[model samples]
Target: MQRKKLSHQVRVSTEDSELFRQSVTGARPLMQDKIAPVSKPGKKKARQAVNLSQNEQQLFFFSDGYEGFVSNSASLSYVQPGDDPHLAGRLKRAEFQPQVVLDLHGLTQQQAKTELAGLLAYCQQQQFNCACVIHGKGLGILARKVPNWLIQHPNVRAFHTAPKSWGKHGALLLLLKINQPELALR
Candidate 1:
């Protein structure tokens, strides 16, 4: 009896569905067909990669003359103008884990600059919001240059000196822009 009832319900549902489909068959689709085009999620990421790779020079240029002087304090912190003012503080508290890391341990200044540019571009391309930059608070040249360069980049949202477990004063936890157009540099 239960099987009969189930079959009956299925038959009724199939008949109703067929009727509904027939009723809609005579109705014309919208003339404009105003649906916007949307790329697949994977394609979107690939497109970003292509855009960054193709137009990288114009996208990420860090100038030493961007600022005459940036303080070299052990506690480094920065936040882009329109971003959350407390972002650096939140980063220091380890609210977001760094998904990628770029270590400048023994690289020359020129090498470091190249690596920095590539890392920043790659982060944007890959849609990574958080990354760690281990500048190794050395004789202060790399540390100082690193922060200055970072501040100049339009995409760096916020950054703070890494906490004890991450790298302490020797590294910085960076909040990078992900899947968003960069804010104009100040």
Candidate 2:
């Protein structure tokens, strides 16, 4: 028997080969272009974690250490003469009544340091007996740094973590200069 050669048409069908070539050319750019990067969530709590409720009071400190509060206070009407940079001024309106507590969870380390000092001076000058400091239970933001500094401050009669209902590990109840609890009344 004689050997026979395969027909050219048998090697590759024209229409199929053209289709394969078109697909390969069309997909080349997709392979060459860099893929879009995917974003990863931070280990820290989500934005919802820090958002406040309807009745929740706002407390924020500026880069210069000026504090702002969202509640009303009777003491806000008693204004001191001369401009004071550290004083909250209108920002001090947050409710500071004996039972009502304010949170300080959002301050940065440096802001908290200044806030601690300003608070001590406020107690020494105006005579507040008790105050709350909300220092959010982050990585040693307040547990180590704030307490260490508070230990040496003059007006800090006592300071401890707040009750669970108020802020738990996220806040502190500061007993200001005890002798002047009456000043808070003035």
Candidate 3:
């Protein structure tokens, strides 16, 4: 035997959507918090590369928002770059290692901006000197946008592609720009 199907008519209106649009239109624009910009016009920006003389103590390796050892406090002194090598080698072989590795692969551009802003803030607050951003190889997803945005942020001291051991070209090593207290210590 075949069963008869019963259906009821449903009514819908755009009232909720219309109200949301109205509210959005009435909302004021968010004011951005201002800060001093790094690498200002005509000012040369400094790169963070540990030289041979800087290898007085072994810098620790930390990642994924966790704290870790600074390796051997004594070996820290030996983590310096010998000479004209690439930036990745310098950072990877530095006495101190980066403390964070932010995975940006799944983030949309808006998400990247928001997360990166938070990461920069965190790096500053925690006195973290270095960070890694895994943006992945440009398969056309984020591509140029992510790297360019990182360079433009004021709190970013330095950023470049990571070495093979440090995540290869899919990641970026980020240096936290030192502020008054941190700068005074250096």
Best by TM-score: 1
lDDT of 2 by residue, 1-186 (tens): 987876655578899999989888846434556778999976976432322331122122222332222215212111123333333332233223333244546777765665555555555455566677677767754555555555445454555555555465566666554463444544
Candidate 1 segments exceeding 4 Å error? 1-60, 180-186
Q: How much lDDT does each candidate structure score?
A: 0.80, 0.49, 0.56
Q: Higher-TM-score candidate among 1 and 2?
A: 1
The Cα error of candidate 1 at residue 27, in Å, is 99
Pairs that collide in candidate 2 are: 71-93, 71-94, 104-134
Which ranking of candidates, highest TM-score first? 1, 3, 2
Clashes of 2: 3
After TM-score superposition, the amount by which residue 134's alpha carbon in candidate 2 deviates from its true location, in angstroms, is 0.8
Tell me the TM-score of each prediction against the true structure. 0.63, 0.40, 0.47
Report the Cα lDDT for candidate 2. 0.49
Error of 2 at 35 (Å): 49
Clashes per candidate (backbone, < 3 Å): 0, 3, 10
TM-score of 1: 0.63
- Residue by residue across 1-186, what tens digits does model 1's lDDT show? 354455444346888999999989879766886788898765434312334453457335677666633555659888988999999899999999998998999999877887788788778778898999998866867888888888888788998999888888888899987777678999
**Lowest lDDT 10-residue stretch of candidate 3:** 54-63
